[model samples]
Target chain A: MQPGISKKRRAYILLMRILMWLSVALTAGLVLFLVTYVMAKGLPEISWNLLTTKPSYLSGNIGILPDILNTVYIIIAALIFVIPLGAGAAVYLNEYARNKKLVAVIEYAAETLSGIPSIIYGLVGMLFFCSFLDMQTSLLAGALTLVIMNLPTVLRTTQESLKTVPQSYREGAFGLGAGKWRVIRTVVLPGCVDGIITGCILSVGRILGESAALLFTAGFAHAVHGFFEGLNSAGATLTVALYVYAKEQGEFGVAFAIAAILMVLTLLIQLAAMLVGRYFKKRRDL
Target chain B: MCLPMKKRQSKIDPVTGGSDIRPPVLWDSLMKKQAFENFIYGVFLLLGLITVGCVLLITVYLIISGIPAIREIGLFKFLFGKTWASTAKTPQFGILPFILTSIYGTAGAIALGVPIGFLTAVYLAKAAPPKVKAVVSAAVSVLAGIPSVVYGLVGMLVLVPGIRSIFHVPDGASLLAAIVVLAVMILPSIVNVSITALEAVPQEYEDASLALGATPTETYFRVSVPAARSGIAAAVVLGVGRAIGEAMAVMMVSGNVANMPSLFQSVRFLTTAVASEMSYSSGLQRQALFSIALVLYLFILLINAALNFFLKRSKEA
Candidate 1:
């Protein structure tokens, strides 16, 4: 639109701008359609009875309480293992590691772990945890598999927060005659609590949505049990249950109901993550 | 303090320990603390090594379990075979169909996804107003956070039927459907990564271009894009990995048939081949599925290496 611009240059800029706008419109439109369509189709199928009771074969009644419980159990188990392991790894990398080569190797391993897909993790988990370890496709095996899958996420988040904790704090601790472990235990670990919390939320979201990884390591079953018993038993999470209902059982109604729940949960998680991140950022700035 | 106390304990305690027992007690407590510190360090070191140990465990298990089927089937036929019939009376375990389908599907997704993703990223990064950028970025993150099954569900109900009615195909589930689902599914990753890369291009570069009398569009394409080409390349590689490794969504819409890939024909991917049969397969059939998984893993490893190379180059740049 500038007065001195050539006609060809003007046309080129116009074309580029139009193309860019079109692409944005397409992406935004796709998201809008998906969110609305899913909510419309899935909301009607969710009922209180459908949520609280277990599936009954004789009465042809289906409920998702078991899947919900399994999801919670698996998330609890995976987090219990992943947090310490991931935080410890991050601490070693940032705090104690003096060997650059070892740091590079560990960081590279984390990257590779993130790059590998869930299905491969499922396969390997099935082979190692379920079969070789003789865990027999229980929820415990699935949780262990998820612990491996989520370690990188937790490690990266914790590492980022660890970096933000000023070196002066550590130096001050040392100045006060504190040893390395004590300094890390008291000062460094507490500073990264936000990151650990953020990582936990992210991991829970992923665990909630994961199907391919859990399909094998955690077999699809509808039986409900207590937390400890659930870990020792084979049961499906909400995502896997949705898959089984839609694909295997021709129960699109149940599938949509579960999908709606999952969609709501995903939104809530995204919001929580944003809030947590902003809260920590504000606190840190203060 | 501990060092001085240890010296005192060594020299004075041996001579008059009964009278001056405080130094020995202090030395013993200090040694215990040091040992505890060492033990805690060892524990942390072990935790750190667990990641490496996991990587090794996965690699070793895949190799050990994946080799047996390959040895039995012979590598050439297994890799280049034309048919895959895992349950037939005389089974044909050739996975050429799967490999080719996977390649074509990923290529198709990249073909469709990268351009739109690149353009959107460019707009968001360089052209959009702040409010627009914020809204679109939120949408992209929402897309990313939506589970694969939800995408598959939407695709199965909406896309498959739409494809069937529009194209006049007997069935809606086909390679084309899978490609479309994958394209949409990978959009968030491509757009997010490319936006990061494009945003990282120095403001000075664009300012220099504008000062040189070039328009913003030309500057972005000719100068800024070229500057961030490595990052864009990494985004594309990442999209490829996501497309190739996706199982559940593709399985839902691809019809789960092991046929040679045509745009409109039902076909299976390497991932779907492993997943669809995993629950029911047994004996040699099961082992063959593991072999398929191994093949898929190798493909992923290669893609991962390429992604790393591009990412490293971008970081260096």
Candidate 2:
């Protein structure tokens, strides 16, 4: 085999090998640089006071408590509404819908929804939810926009896990005189818990990272309030806050702190997704 | 209902409790259950349509708001005209600069990003050890998960300044800076999708090539890569969509100026053009912002259609 190789061919192979290794190194290097650079610059800026207080013009100091709370409120609000709609759509696709054409149309729509960028979502959200619907630039409008954006993720995941539920189990339930709703409620829905949870994690990660979509729908206000009050008022999530701070206010310290927090959250979400995947795999194997 | 059920029960007598109460009771409950099931089914069916309804709403909203500006500005002048001074005394609404900048910037990102990402995918899919692959893939996922704002922050504070000094430019924020940020941002999609496509190539293809006295590297590239070209193309299309649609990251570094795009000149993209002006714009300017969004949306729709085409072809192949 070695003797059969010509010098030109060997040189080409060597070049490719070198190129392959170099590209991989560059990819890895970029990731490393980003993670370490953000963390190194940001972690020191985070403080107990910074996380727990609000910005006061009198004090001429800034804090992100309101932004943090708004993030939590929007995430919760979006999930509360989205899970039911998303899971219901999945159930319809998996258990109820008999029309293949209808299912295909819905799936295609979901794909389109996912492909449309967040900026477009912001524009439409501002138009329909904020202006047309008279919701104004409030967190509620932002949450509704996110529900539409994440609906596909939730539906796809639930549909995947629903397929894994054995058909024999469904038949057995039917044989025992269980109605269609009963069969889904007792057998199919439980089987999809893992997917729904995974979807929630992914949505949370997206919600945390999102800024452009919320910029118009959720105006950048730093008001701390209860969940219902928060939803009615305009506010900024961490990502939006980071953008405003960095771009407009020139507050690099606060921006970096938020970046670090987001990075850590991203890491945690990745870990949780992997762990959930492994756990489900082991249970299925068993 | 109770009276009828009692009469039916009495008709069968108390001889067999199970058999006596079965017919009317069963019929009644079955009808009720069927109605309930139908109700729930309709509810869920409605739920499924909600996603479709949302897509329609977005499309309709964009068109309705987007048309006025174009109608006023003239489509040719709006899209092809070379000036975009929304606040000038006479105000020109031409968006050629934003359009060209978006196109050139996306092209630049693809040019710089795809080769490295493709090579990396090949290495991860075929050449790297299992342990190394695992670590690198995790890193890639982290890159994907980082918020766009963070990328902008890093680019603003680091890459822009670096470019300004290295290239001897007056301003750090330029189209070149935006391109570099976009190239980094799109790396994850290209690498991940290409790796998947490469890994999906059947083992037997490589096995046969190896048995034919071809080197492993040769077999991997010539056989495996050709087999996965459709998937790689789909990945590239996906990256193009991402690069073109990005707003926040590009907005932060591209300087928000509506200049004709040059490598080191400050420029605005289609996405940034909409985002930066929406807050304060009024009258025709406001409608024109909507029109800009419409343009960006149309670009995204084209990218999405191309992505779907590539993906469908890949699946078929």
Candidate 3:
């Protein structure tokens, strides 16, 4: 449309613009359709019975309480192990590392771990944790596998936050005769709480959505138990249960109900991450 | 001078507790504290190396558990075999079908997904209004966050049936269905990463292009996109990794048949081949499943190296 533009150039520009608009429309339309379709078909199937009890063949009743409990147990166990390890690695890299080669190697390893697929993780977890360690196919074994999967997330977030902490703070602590351990424990660790919390939310979302990694390590059983008992016994989380109910059993109703629950949880986790990130960013600015 | 020295001495006294603490006691406590610090430092160093240890463990275990079956089956047959009937009497364990299906499926997804994702990223980064960009970006994140199983469920219910009716195929669950689902599943990553890359292009370059009488769209495509080409390449490679590694979503729609991967035929990918039979397999079948996983890992390693190369280039640029 510009005065100097030729007919061919104008046609090319017009075609590119149309393509751009069409792509945006298609992408946005797909998201809208998926959310509405899942919600409409899924919300009606959720009920009090589905949330409170276990599935029983005698009465042909289906429930998700056990799966919910198993999911919670795995999340708790994985977090307990991953937090300390991930945070410690971040601290060591930022505050204590003197060898550049070691730092590069550690970073590369983290990247490689993230790139490996969940199915491979499942295979290795089955071989190493369930068989080699003799943990059996239980929630604990699944949780241990997830700890490795999520370590890179926690490390990267904590490292980013660590970089934002001022160097003057560390110098002041040392000036007061504090040792390296004391300085990190008192000054550096506290500053990275927001990052750790954000990482946790993201990891929880990934764990909730995971199925391939859990299928082999955590066998599917619809029994309910206490925390320690649950870790010892094999169980299925919500995602795995959805897969089994839909693919093998052809139980579409139960699968949809579970999908709806996961959708809501994913949205909530995203919102919480955004809020935590904004709150910390504002505080840091001040 | 006497007065200043007296004041300084008083100040030092208050801090040192009037010199009651002898040099040996102070030195001894400092040494203990130093040792304790070293101990804590060592603990952190151990933690840092755990990631390295994990990577080594996965590699070693995959090779150890994944090789016996290959050695037994012959490496050529294992890699290039055309059949995968692990449960059949006198099982045939060639994985050529799986290898081809995975490659074809990933290529299909990339072919369908990248152009759309790239155009959307260009629009978002260069042309869209702030409100539209924010809304679309949030939608994209939601797409990313949705569980892959939900995508599978939707595809199974809607896409498979729709494809069956429209295409008049006997079985709707085929390689085509898997490719469609995967294209949708990979859209978010391509769009999000490309948007980041496009946004990183220096504004001065665009301004110069515009000043030289190029249109805004021309400037974006000609000037900005070239500057961020490496990042965009990295994004496409990342999408390839996701498409190849995906198991459950593809499993639900692809019919899980070990065919040679025609668009309209049921086929099995490497990831699904391991997952579908792991529950009931034993002996050579189980070890062969591990071998399949090892092959998938090699594919991922190659993709990771490519991703790192592009990412490093982008950083330097």
Clashes of each: 0, 0, 0
Interface RMSD of 2: 4.2
Residue B242 of model 2 has an lDDT of: 92
Model 3 bad stretches (over 4 Å): B1-22
- List, residue by residue over A209-281, the lDDT tens digit for candidate 1: 8999999999998898999999999999999999999998989999999999999999899999999999999
Residue A94, candidate 3: alpha-carbon lDDT: 93
- lDDT per residue, candidate 1, B46-94, as tens digits? 8888889989888888888888999999999899999898899999899
Per-residue lDDT of candidate 2, residues A1-286 (tens digit): 3896999999989999999999999999999999999999999999999999999999987999999999999999999999999999999888877679999889889988888989999999999999889999999999999999999999998889999999999999988978788888999999889999989999999999999999999999998999999999999999999999999999999999999999999999999998998899899889
**Second chain alone, TM-score for each candidate:** 0.92, 0.92, 0.93
**On residues A110-205, what C-alpha lDDT tens digit does candidate 3 reach at each position?**
999999999999999999999999999999999999999999999999999999999999999988977788788999999899878888998999
| List of clashing residue pairs for candidate 3 | none
Model 1 interface CAPRI class: medium
Error of 3 at A129 (Å): 0.8
Among these predictions, the greatest DockQ belongs to 1
Off by over 4 Å in 1: B1-23
The CAPRI class of candidate 3 is medium
- Residue pairs with backbone overlap in model 2: none
